[model samples]
Target: MKNALLIIDMQQGLFHGPHIPYAASSVLSNIRLLIKKARSSGTPLFFARHTGPDGSPFSEQSPLTQLIPELDVNVEQDSIFIKKYPNCFRDTVLLQQLKLRNIDQLVIAGMKTEICVDTTCRAAFDAGFKVVLVSDAHTTIDNPALTADNIVRHHNQTLAGPFVSLVSTEEWVA
Candidate 1:
């Protein structure tokens, strides 16, 4: 089956913000590794960038909307989808792009585990895509109700059986 990598909202705004994602550095490392592996394997890479209204961090006019500099994003090799919502498939060309590439499976990773990541995983599943969530490659900041770690842990458990197959970066790479 053809597989692709879908990295959502790994943008400069999120990383440069006051409350950074939990395990941000390690998650970036894992995402980088996944990108490298996907490149080498000829798996297409799809990036979903969230855009917000003017004055917001992810506003189109804001530099924060740009992908983080640490990621090895090649414009010629990667497909980028601009989104306004948490679900990447919502009003986005992500599904079309994947279908064009004959990609039936998606390896999803990126920022805001409890929001975009969780939403995208389920959306992908509902859209009939086989999704594998890189458990250690997606992260988010802590909320008032829960720590970031617990949020990640909770989503992983909740999404595993019905929404996605879970794999760590090491397992995915190897």
Candidate 2:
């Protein structure tokens, strides 16, 4: 099965101030590792970024709309997709790119584990792609009721098996 690494919403906005996900450092580390592996293995890498209207956080003039500087993405070397919706495929050409790359399996990692990450995982599955989440490479912010840790754990457990398979950074061979 051909696989592509899909890094979703790892933008400057998400890492700033109160929007930072839990275990941000570790999550970034894992994402870096995954990026390195994908590069070495010649696996295709696709990035999904969230954008908003003129006044929102992801406005064109905002630095937050850009990918984090720490991410190892080269504009000339990788593909970047922008979506206004939480579901990466909703308003983007993500699926088209996947089809062009002949990718049927996806290795996903990114921010807002409960939102974009979760929604994309399920949508990818429903669209008939094999999906595996770099579980530790995705994270969330604390909500009114639950801590970010709890949300991560809950989604990891709930989203496993059916929507996506889970793999830790250590166990991720690809």
| Model 2: per-residue Cα lDDT over 20-89, one tens digit each | 6899999998999999888989999899888889987678667887888788788998999889888889
* Tens digits of per-residue lDDT for model 1, 12-61: 88866788789988999999999999999999999888999888766887
lDDT (CA) per prediction = 0.91, 0.89
Clashing pairs in 1: none
RMSD of each: 1.0, 1.2
TM-score: which candidate is best? 1
Error of 1 at 76 (Å): 1.3
Among all candidates shown, the one with the greatest lDDT: 1
Question: Any runs in candidate 1 off by more than 4 Å, and if so which?
Answer: none
